[model samples]
Target: METRPLDVLNRGRDKRIVIILKNEKEITGKLQAFDIHLNMWLSDAEVSDSEVTKKYGKLLVRGDNIVCASPE
Candidate 1:
């Protein structure tokens, strides 16, 4: 498997992860912070065009909202 930032997203803080959110939106950024609701705080996010349409930000993503992740 390809190790990218997203892969480590579920691992917790201080870890790198690339998050692929719902609506086929991919965000490649560090896991700066998160909450109990699975909402993430990211930095250096390389979001996809689809995400732009959804108005992505600090990323209030829910666990079920996530499609996949990688460690980059």
Candidate 2:
């Protein structure tokens, strides 16, 4: 069987994940949903940079803004 990136993400559902955006923002949260475009929905989300951290109950991240994602 071939292993794919999305496959890895699928397996990571309901787990904590960290997303790095093109703008250099980092977000950490629980994975709730995602799509082929890499657009994602996250719960208990936190967005952070060198200066500050903000929290949200839910977050929608556009695929185009995402540089990478990994387990937290």
Candidate 3:
């Protein structure tokens, strides 16, 4: 059987993903949801101890803003 690249990445709910934001910041969080447009919602982010906490409930990351995403 041939495996697709997305298949490897698409581990589904609660999967950990490392997102690199456009502001040059990196966040590692659980995959919360995904829209039809492929927009991702990440929650319970594991950030640095010294990092300032975000005011938002969930991080709203644009697809284009993502530098790279990998399993954590």
Candidate 4:
């Protein structure tokens, strides 16, 4: 069977995932929601980098700013 990216993303809902942004920032969280445009909402989000780590109860990421997403 052939599956599209969205199909994979849909399957990832409510699961832990890592989102990579255009700026090379990485955010890890539970997938809450997503749209055809790739706009996404993540719950219990966290950004971990060389400098520091930030946390959020919820996060909305614009589609244009997203580089890629994968299961955590």
TM-score winner, 1 or 4: 4
Tell me the alpha-carbon RMSD of every candidate.
5.7, 1.3, 3.5, 1.3
**Which regions of candidate 4 fall more than 4 Å away from where they truly are?**
none
lDDT by residue for model 2 (1-72), tens: 637778888888999999999999999999999999999999999999999999999999999899999974
Q: Which candidate model has the greater lDDT, 2 or 4?
A: 2
Which prediction has the highest TM-score against the true structure?
A: 2
Which 10 residues in a row give candidate 4 its minimum summed lDDT?
A: 1-10
- Using all chains and alpha carbons, the TM-scores for the candidates as numbered come to 0.54, 0.93, 0.62, 0.89
Name model 2 segments beyond 4 Å from true. none
The lDDT, on a scale of 0 to 1, for candidate 1 is: 0.62
- From the highest lDDT down, the ranking of the candidates is 2, 4, 3, 1
Model 2 TM-score is 0.93
Question: What are the lDDT figures for the candidates, one per model?
Answer: 0.62, 0.93, 0.65, 0.87
Model 3 lDDT per residue over 1-72, tens place: 437544545666678787666677777778887654446787876543346644344765667666667765
* lDDT accuracy of residue 63 in candidate 2: 92
Residue runs of model 1 more than 4 Å from their true location after superposition: 1-12, 49-64
